[model samples]
Every structure is written in C-alpha cells, then in structure tokens.
Target: MKIRSVVLAAGLIGFSAVASASSFVGTTNAIGSILANTANALGDSTASTFGSDKVVLQAREDAASFVGSNGDLRGVNLEAALGHIRHQMPELQASDMQLAEAILAL
Candidate 1:
C-alpha cells in the first residue's frame, strides 16, 4: 500500500509538471506573437514616418540588443523577457523547463 501511494504521488507530480509546461508553452507562444506584432508595427511606423533607411538602422540596432555573449536569451525567462533579452534563443527542449523553473525560483 505504501508503494502504491508513492507511485500514485509520483504520477500526480508528473501530470502536474506536464500541465504546467503545457501552460507555459501556450503563454510563450502568445507572447512571441505579441512581440512579433509589436516589432512589425514599430517598423511600419518608423518606415512611414522616417523612411526606409531609418527602419533598416533600427532593425540592426534591435538585432544587436537582442543577442548575448553566450548566444542565449539574456534573462531568467526567455519568453517573458522578449525584447529585453540580449539574444533570440527559442526554448526548444525539455531542459529549458528546468532553466525556466530555476529563474522563477530566483
């Protein structure tokens, strides 16, 4: 009975972790879409007001600001940080969940 209880608890913990990761994925996707839209809008506005050259310059600056020395997203939560990070590092693996959790813990 004790063993069964332990197994059940472990299963529940796994399920909760999965659910949490799923929710984080959805939120991250939404945030990415929002950031893309914002960048697009900014580019459009800058191009319309200043000109194509200024928009190009702004894009270059943004790219530099988004990249980090380690080539990773320069923050605790990659998705949440978005434009603030020094690089564009997409969370592509399960290990990223650990990193995200660590960041949140801090």
Candidate 2:
C-alpha cells in the first residue's frame, strides 16, 4: 500500500510539471500571435500610406510600442532577425523593437 501511494504521488508530481509547462507554452504562443499580428498591421499600414520603402521604420516604431518599456523578447526567435537588421542598419540598437521590425521586414 505504501509503494502504491508513493507511485501515485510521483505520478501526480510529474503531471503537475507537465501541466505547468503546457501553460507556459500556451501563454508564449498567444503572445507570439499578438506580436505577429501587430507587425503585419504595421507593415500593411506603412505599405498603404507611406509606401513599402518606409515600412521598416514604421515597423520599428510599432514594434517598440508592442514591446513596451520592458522590451521583453521572450518566445520570439529575435536573435536571427537582429543579425539581419544589424547587417542592414549597423547603427540600430539591439532592442526588442528593432528585432521585431527585422522579422516584419522578412
């Protein structure tokens, strides 16, 4: 009976960890979707108003707002985008907005 209780407790602990991980993944995915939608909107608005040439700059501004003051870049593969942006605009800072804009450009 003790062995059975121990096994059940262990199973519950494992299940709890899995649930926590799943929740984290779900939250990350939701945030990513919001960021992507915002980026797309910025790109489309820029293309319509100022033209495609200005989209990158507009994207940067919009992305900055999306990231807020904290500039959290979690759940996004922003490093790769940052590399590309750095190549194009060497003076741009390695901020969350710049990274988001880079992804938007692609």
Candidate 1 per-residue C-alpha lDDT over 12-81 given as tens digits, one digit per residue, 9 for 90 to 100:
9999999999999999999768555654554443334334333233334223333423235443235443
Q: Candidate 2's residue-wise lDDT over 11-98, tens digit each?
A: 9999999999999999999988876776676445334433443434445444554456545533323444344456666764445563
Best by lDDT: 2
Clash pairs, model 2 backbone: none
**What are the runs in model 1 whose C-alpha is more than 4 Å off?**
48-51, 54-59, 62-106
Model 2 residue 62 CA deviation (Å) reads 12
Give lDDT for model 2: 0.57
* Top TM-score model: 2
Cα lDDT of model 1 overall?
Answer: 0.45
